[model samples]
Target: MKIFLLTEAGKNIGSGHITRCIALSQAFIEKGLYPYFVINGDNSVKDLFKDKKYIIFNWLEERKRLFNLIKTSDIVIIDSYLADNTLYKGISENAKLCVYIDDNKRIDYPKGILVNGGIYSLKLKYPKKRNLIYLLGFQYTILRKEFWYVGKKKVKKNIKDVMITFGGADTKNITTKVLRLLTNEFPNFNKKVVIGKWFRNFNLIKKQKDERTEFIEWADANKMKELMMKSDIVVSAGGQALFEFAQVGLPVIIIAANDKNQLKNINEWKKTGFIEYAGLWKDKNLENSLLNKINFVNNYNTRLQMSYNGKRILKKNGSLNVVSKILQELTNKE
Candidate 1:
């Protein structure tokens, strides 16, 4: 079967959609199906599955190309939240089967299946007659094969290495504010800052070359996971990085830097005591909540509980499996 996967990747969009789609793509390959990615250009994900089948197009001008790809494709998988009515209509009409991976509740998904592979996504309800396959909740979150294979070592044996990853770039330099707060607290701890190449304030982060921290830029997938596995504490965004942390059993602080959406997720995670959040765009009580979590990171019980919670959510790497089932059903539907 020929599958066309539509996703956006890069500095502007972040890597969650593309990364998860690739994981599903791998499963398709394992089953001897041909999966070709139709992505928006210039992203770390482009290099990740470099040898895999793909054709990049500009998101703004891909309607013609999209319908054309859909015509030739036996199946079309969409992972873009920003895809509007026009785009969705065209792709759904042309492809024999169209599977959409979505999280937002606002979209009108009148055709095909809407797969939401996150825990919070469960709250989103869909219309009954739309032929939708809502794969809601973390039970379907996707992670690459490496995350699944990266063995978890004992916490005590792991170095006191802390990882700071905000979306490949915080257009707002939220990383700077986070680093400022964390540097003083963990003065002697081994720290690494992932400064994304596509980051808007690349120069500012590059200048943060100090003795207390290791600076990594445009890092490869292997190295990124290595640091995540080795780290004792992680201050990261609530996107794909969360899955990596969950896979390796690392204690983390969710940084809802980019938008309010991450903040909503952070609050939900907080209720479970799994991870702590530090919203970059704070109003008044920034010092209290932010520092408190940093302090909690040092406590034994808090850290252990967080690690255990990571494992609880870890069972959800069913993205590949779930998508495969959905596709099989969609193809057999009529």
Candidate 2:
């Protein structure tokens, strides 16, 4: 079967959607299916699909062409916020099977399979429609293979190392602000910052580097897991990193990123006692607020409990589960 992933990635859009698509694509590959990406993204996004089969379409200028190409797919799965109801309807009418990987029920979706992989997905009220299969909550969280088999992290008593990441595109440069404050105030703690391709403040971040600070760029899933495993605590933008950290059983402080969907996901996950919620980056007192949360979660008991609770809530079999269901549906069609 040919599975086509309809998604976008780049500096403006961020990488969460494409990242999850890649994870799902890998699942499809393991089932002996070839996956193709239909992308509307920047050069950085092109680099990401260098090893895969993909085609570029300018969604703005080539709507007819894009829809025409999508109509030929066996299974078309969309994971983009930019796609409107018109696009969704077109895909639903054309494809043999249409699946939407949604975080929030923001659109008036047509008849199709809806998958919400967020921790708070169960609480969402999706519109009832015929021929719609809802795969909600943790059972469908599509994490990469590297994050799947991670051994739970061992949090140290005194917090020796802290890993800071703000998603694929830290557009507002939150990492720089947090890193500066962290390096100046808490020089004793070993700091590791994961810089993505879209980070604009790399030069500025480089200036803040000290013996205790290290920067990691273009981290594949394995490198990401390694860094998370080594750290005692993590300060991250509330994106896919939150779920991965939760799976690894690392105590986390979530600073809201630019994505509205991610902000919602983070706020919901914060209620579970697994993550400490720092205010959004736009807040005037974000640095101080984040520092306070960091200090608050530094205790051995707090870290240990957070780790324990996170592990208890997250399941690592989501990719396999989702794949099995999709394959089953496809098999029945025959």
Candidate 3:
């Protein structure tokens, strides 16, 4: 069966969603199913689909062309919030539409599936919507293959080399702020700052580099996963990294970078205990609070408990499973 997968990625949003989509697309390839992508533009994530041709439609004209293309494909799965109800309505009438969501924004989408693979299990109560499947929880969290390979580590006191990663682009520059505050507050600890490719404060981050602080300019998901495995403690923004950190059994300090739907997801996940909040930019004393999280999660006893808890809560290699199930359901409908 043919599928049109719509997702957006760039230096702006860190390409996590699109990257996960690639993992899902890989499952389609294994099953000999066709998965065509519709990307906002060419990106690092798009490289995953070397064999697939993705259609490029500007946001304004996207609605018109996407529906026309959906009519031809057996299933339409969008991993973006950019696609609205009008697009869903047209696709719902003509083809099976499955939406991937992490944002808490409510929608009147019908005749499709709403899928969220966040760390915390999700639940959406729509008003008697028909044929709607809300695939909630972390068992369905979509992540790249590298993160699933759990690694060995030694978190002996200050031996825990903390690797703190915000998203690819710190639009708010939280990483820089966190690092600055951490060094002064927790002089006993060592750190590895994953300065994302698009981080604006390169000069500031580079200047702060020392023996205790190892600054990484950029590392692909594979390398980043290895770094995360090596670290005993992690303090990062709550995005795709939150799930990856959890999957690796790293105790994390989850800070919300953006103030919208992603923020809502972070809030929900905070209650689960696997991830604890470090507060966003608004809090008066966020830096000290973050230091506390580092100290708390870094403990041998706490870290051991978190590792055991992570194994119980998260599914192993969920991308292939989720993609396969969605594809199977769509083909069965045909």
Candidate 4:
């Protein structure tokens, strides 16, 4: 079966969409199917697709080329914030199976599968339509293969290590701000700061590193999972990473890094008791609010409960479940 995964990533656009697409692609590969990536991104995204099939071009602009490439595909999965109704309709019409990966109801998607793996997807109340196959809620949350089968996490009694990770772009530069706050407030705690590929403040962040601070740069999924496992607690941007943190059962404090979707997801995930919602990154008192949450989660019991809630909500088989359902749908159609 020919499979094509469509998404976008860049310094300004962020890499969350591509990250989840890669997870789904890994699921396809495990089924002995190699998926082709059609990305609307810059050169920075090339490293993420190493040893994989991909073609980088602005599919939004070059619709003809994109249609030409995926016209004969058995399956086409599109995960994007920029794609419009027209673009979606084109892909839905062309492919034998069209899957739209959604975070928020960005548009009234055309016929095919609508996959919203967000924790609060069901709450959105998508209308029941015969043409649409809805794969909603945390059971379908798309996460990297590394996080698929996480073992039980050992939550430490004392919060010694704290991890700080914004998304790949860190467009609002929340990492450095949070790092500086951590350094000043939690002097004794070891800080693991994840620096993304498109971090413009890399030099500034590097200068802030001290004996208690370590920088993890451009880490792959395995390395990311390892760090999350080792850390006592996490301060992260409200993005796809939160799902990964939940998979590992880590207590997290989230900063909605200037994205509406992140803000919405953070609020929903907050209700689950797994994450503490620090105000948006642009808020005037974000630093103070984050510090207060950090102190609150520092308590051993609080962290333990958060960890428990996280693991309880996510079962770590989301990717496989999504793939299985999609394939079943394809079979039924056949």
The models' CA-based lDDT, in order, is 0.71, 0.83, 0.69, 0.88
- Cα lDDT, model 4, residue 181: 89
Better of 2 and 4 by lDDT: 4
Answer with 1 or 2, whichever has the higher lDDT: 2
Per-residue CA lDDT of model 2 for 27-112, tens digit only, reads 88777887889888866678788789998776645778876776776788889888888878877887888889987787988776
lDDT of 2 at 192: 93
TM-scores, all models, native as reference: 0.90, 0.95, 0.86, 0.97
TM-score of candidate 1 to 2 decimals: 0.90
After the best TM-score superposition of candidate 1, give how far the Cα of residue 226 lies from its true spot, in angstroms.
1.3
**Cα lDDT tens digits for candidate 1, 127-217:** 6764766666777777776676667546753336778887655665767766666666666767788877567776666554457878787
Best by lDDT: 4
Give each model's clash number.
2, 0, 2, 0
Ranking by TM-score: 4, 2, 1, 3
Over 4 Å off, model 1: 42-46, 157-159, 282-288
> How many clashing residue pairs, candidate 2?
0
Our model 2 lands, by Cα RMSD against the true structure, at 1.6
Better of 1 and 3 by TM-score: 1
